[model samples]
Target: MQISYLQQWLTTPTYKIHRSQLRFWFSLSLTFSVIYSVLALELAFRGNYLIDSDARQHVFWMQRFLDPALFPNDLITDYHQSVAPSGYAALYWLIAQLGIPPLILNKLLPTLLGVITTSYCFATCLQLLPVPAAGFIASLVLNQTLWMRYDLVSGTPRAFIYPLFLAFLYYLLRRSLLPCLIALALQGLFYPQCVFISSGILVLQLWRWHKGRLCLSGNKQDYLFCVAGLGTAFLVMLPYALQSSEFGAVITAAQAKISPEFLPGGRTPFFHDNFLEFWFYGKRSSLVPRLSRITPLIYTGLFLPFLLWKSSQFPLARQVTPKVQVLIQGIIASLGMFVIAHVLLFQLHHPSRYTMHSLLVLLALAAGITLTVSLQALFNWAKCSPKSYPWKGYLARGTTVFLAIVLIIYPVFTPFPYAKYKQGKEPLLYEFFSQQPKHIMIASLSEEANNIPSFAQRSVLTSEMYTIPYHVEYYNQIRQRTIDLIRAQYSADLTLARNVIETYGADFWLLDRTAFTPEYIRGSNWLMQFSEARAVVTELEQGIIPALSGIMEQCSVLETEYLVVLPTDCILKFAQRKRN
Candidate 1:
C-alpha cells in the first residue's frame, strides 16, 4: 500500500464510519497493544533475573505454599500470607504447583495482562464511539500510560485492577449481565477496594439526569443490572468484614490519623500538613496523580468536550453513543469514593484508588478520540492543495506521522518509570542468605531488607517498604519491633541487644557499615515512623558507643563491603565467654 493511502485509511472519518472500518480499527488496536507489551516484557528479561518491588511483599509468601517449609514460623511470611485475598493466593499457588516459581510468574503475567487490559479498553472506547480508530488510539495511549508505570509490571493484586475493571466496563457497555457479574466478582476477589468503586458506578447507572432535572432511569433493565452487580459486590466483600483475622481488628480511621505511619515522610502517608495536597493533590491522594505529566498525551482529553460541543466544526461528535455517559458516571463514582476515603482515611484504603483507575481510562478514551479527530481533519484538509503553498500537504503529512511516532513512544523513552519497579541488586548476598536454615530470621535496618524475602527466600523482622499498618494487631507488633530493633542496634548495653534477640528470635543481626550513624536514622523515611528511631539518632549524635558496633566486628558470620551479618547466638556466646 502507498504511504498516503495507508495514512488516509488509518485516519478515521468524523462521519459515516462503517462496520468493516470498526473491525479493522479493533484489529489494529490489538496489534499495537501486543507490540507495546512485548517491548516491556523484553525489558524484564534484560537482566539475569528480575523481581517486581511490590511483589516483594505480596508474592514472596506464595513460595511457601509451593513448598511447605520455605518460611516456617515466620512472622513476615505468615502476615503477608494471611493478608492476601484467597483468590489471589490461590491463583499463585496453582501456578506455583504447576512448576512455575513466583518470581518467574511475576515476570510473565504483565504481558498477558497488558494485552487483556488494552483489548477491553479498546472495546469500551468502541462502545462509547463507534469510529473504530478512536478506540484504536485510546487503547494505544492507555497501553503506553500503563507501561510507563509499574502498574502493569508489578503484577501484584493492584495490577489486576486495570484488566478486571476495564473488562467490567466493556461488559457493562455490551449489557452482558453474566460476564459483567463475573468481572465484578473477580475484582472483588482480587482487589476488594475496587468492588466498592464498581458498586458506586453501577448504582449511578440507575439514576439519570433529564433536561435540567434529576430522575430515575426509565429502563427497568438499569435497576436489574444495579441490583445484580451491587449484590455480587456485597456478597464478595462480606467475607472480609465477617472473618476475624489473627492479626486482629482492622485499624480504625481514628487510630490511623494519630499513628506516625500516616504522617509526612512515613510509609503510606496520607495526611499532609499542606491542606491543598491532603485534600486534592497528594501523590496517593490526588484525583489523577503524576500520570498526566508523565504521558502528556492525556492533555489532549481536555479538548474532547470542546470538539464535541461544537458538533458542526467537529462532526465526530455525531458518532458518540449516550453510553459514553457511563464513563462520566465512573468518574463521579471514583471522586465520591476518593472524598469518602479521605474523610474515612485508611478505612476505605488509599484515596488515589478511587480516581487513578477511572481517570486514566477516561482520559485515554477522550484523548484517543481527540487525537483521532485532529488527524482526520488535518488529512482531509491536506487533500485540497492551497493554490499558493504546495508544501501545505507535505507539512500536514509530516505532522501526522510525527504525532503518531510521539504517541507510540511517549513514555517508553523516559529515563525513569513513573512507578518504582525495583529489582534486587545483590545476587551474591541473596544466595548466601538463601543457604541458611528455613526457620532462621534476620534483623536489619538496611533498605535491602525489603528485597530479601523475594530474592533470598528468607524472612526479615521488618522492612521499610512492607510496613502497611492496616491492622491493629499487626501494626502494634511491627511498631514495637521497629522500636526494639532500632534501640538494640544503638544500645551500648549488651543486655538490650540480647533482649531483642530473645524477644523476636533474631538468629542473625544484619548491619550495614553505616547502620549506627545518626544520619542513617534521621534520613530514612521509614525509620522516622518509629518512636524509637528519633531517640536513637539523638543518642548516637551525643557520641554514645553502640553495642552492635563493637560486636559486629567480633561476631561477624558474613561480610560484604557495606553489609555485616552478626550471628545473634555468636554475640551471646561472646558475652558468656567474657563472663566466664
Candidate 2:
C-alpha cells in the first residue's frame, strides 16, 4: 500500500534521524546562546547588581552562603521573602565553593543557564517547525525581544525558566512524554511559576487525549504521568517551601507595626494621559515603555490585519485538528494568565514587566506567520516542478538563515545599551560607595541605597525597610517600637530626632536627592526638622532632578554639590546639640 504524504513525512526514518540536521541547528543555537551569555557575564561583573525591592531578597540569600547556618533551617528570609529557588541558588553555591566570588557568580551562572536555555529553545523550535531555518528564526526573534535585557543584565530567575519551559513544550508537542515530564519536574524545582504554566499545558494535553489525537495505551498511564510529574516536582520543591514558611511570621509582625496603606497599590490605571511623553519626549529613560502604551490602538490596528493576512496566505494556518487546536488554545490560555494577573493583581505601574510572556507569545505568532508567508512567496516565485519545489525543504532553509542573522547578530550590534539602561541608579550609587570606606550606617529614601552596604562594606538602610519589610520585618518591628518609645518621651522637637538617632544607632543620613526633595519633606514635620540639622556632605544629582522641581521644595539642602550626602560640620553640631 502506498503511504499518504502526511504519513510518509511523519513516519519516515530520514525524518526521525535528528542527528543529520543536529549540526546546523546546534551551531545556530550556540551562536545566539554565546551572545546572551557574554552579555550576562558583562553585566554581572562590570555592571552594578541591584533589582528593585523584590530582588534584594535574592542578594540576601547569596550573602548567606558565607555561613549556611545564617539562614535558619536553610531558608531564605528577606523582604517579600520566600523559599529560594533551588536551581539557581544551588548553582551559585557550587560556584561559590569553587572560589568564584558572589559578584562574578551572580553574573556567570545566570549567563550559563541562559545559554543552555536558549540552545534548548532552538532545539524545541526545530522540532515544531522541522525547518532548519525555523530554529534560527524563532531563536532570533526571541533573542531580539530583549530576553538578554532582563536575564543577562538583571539575572532574573524568570529568564532562566522561560527557555526551559519552551523546550518542555516542544518535547510535549513531539509526544516525548518522559522527557516532557522530566523537564516539567525540573522547572518546578527552579521556578514555581512554572507550575501555573505546566498546569495549562497538561490541560491541553488531556484535551488532545480526549479527542483521540494522543494515542496513549491507557488512561491509567496518562493519569500516572500527570501525578508523577506533579508529585516529583513538589518533592523537589519541598525544601524551599518549608524555608519560606518562616516568612509569614515576619510579614505578620511587620503589618502589625506599620499601616496597611503604606504598601504601594499593585494596581494602577492601565492607560495614563502622560503615555506619549515617554515614547516621544523621554526616549532615554531607564524604564522600558510598554509597547501597548507606545501605540495605544496598534494592537488592534496591526495585529488583526497581520494575523488575518498571514492566515489567508497559509492554508494550514487555520487550526484544524484537535491537537493543533489544543496547542492554539494553550497559547491563548497562557496569555490569559498574564492578562488576569495584570488586570487584577499587579499594580498597573508596571504592566509592561508583567506582560512580558504575553508579548513573547504575540511576537512568536508574528514570527511564525512572517516565515511561513515569506517562504511560500519564495516557492511560488521559483516555480520549480513538484519534485524540485520542496515546499518544506525551502522553508527549513530560509528560516534558518533569517533567524541566524536576526537573533544572534542583531542584539550584539544593536545600540540599545540595555544593560546600562537597566542598571538605573544602582550603578551610580555603587561607584560612590566604592570610593568610601566608612563603617557608618547610611539611610536613604531610595532602595538603591541598600546596595551601598555591598560596595562600601558598611551598614545601610532605606525606606524599603518599611515597604518590603520581608524577613527583616521581625527585626524592624522591634526597632520601630524602640523608636516610638524614644519619640513619645522626647516629643517632635530636635530632642526627638536626637533620641531616635541614638536609639537606632545610626551615624549617617544619606538622602536620595531625587526622591526626598524640599517639597516632599515639607509635608513631613519630622523630615523637615531632620534636614535642617543634617549638614550636606554631597548632593546626589541626576538629570531627572531638575524636572521634579514641584517635589523639590519639601527638601532642604544638607549638601551643596548634589553628589551624595555625608554629614558635614554644621549638621554634626546640630545633631550633637539635639543629643545634649
- Tens digit per residue, CA lDDT, model 1, 42-100: 67667763767778788888888667888778866788888898778888888888999
Q: Candidate 1: which stretches are off by over 4 Å?
A: 1-8, 11-24, 377-399, 416-419, 577-580
Residue 202 lDDT in candidate 2? 63
Where does the lowest 10-residue lDDT sum fall in candidate 1? 412-421
> Against the true structure, whose TM-score is highest?
1
lDDT of each: 0.79, 0.46
Model 2 agreement with the true structure over 287-312: per-residue lDDT tens digits: 23433222121122124235344665
After superposing candidate 2, which stretches have Cα over 4 Å from the reference?
1-22, 39-57, 67-77, 80-83, 174-179, 209-221, 233-289, 292-326, 335-355, 358-370, 384-417, 420-440, 446-448, 464-466, 469-493, 511-580
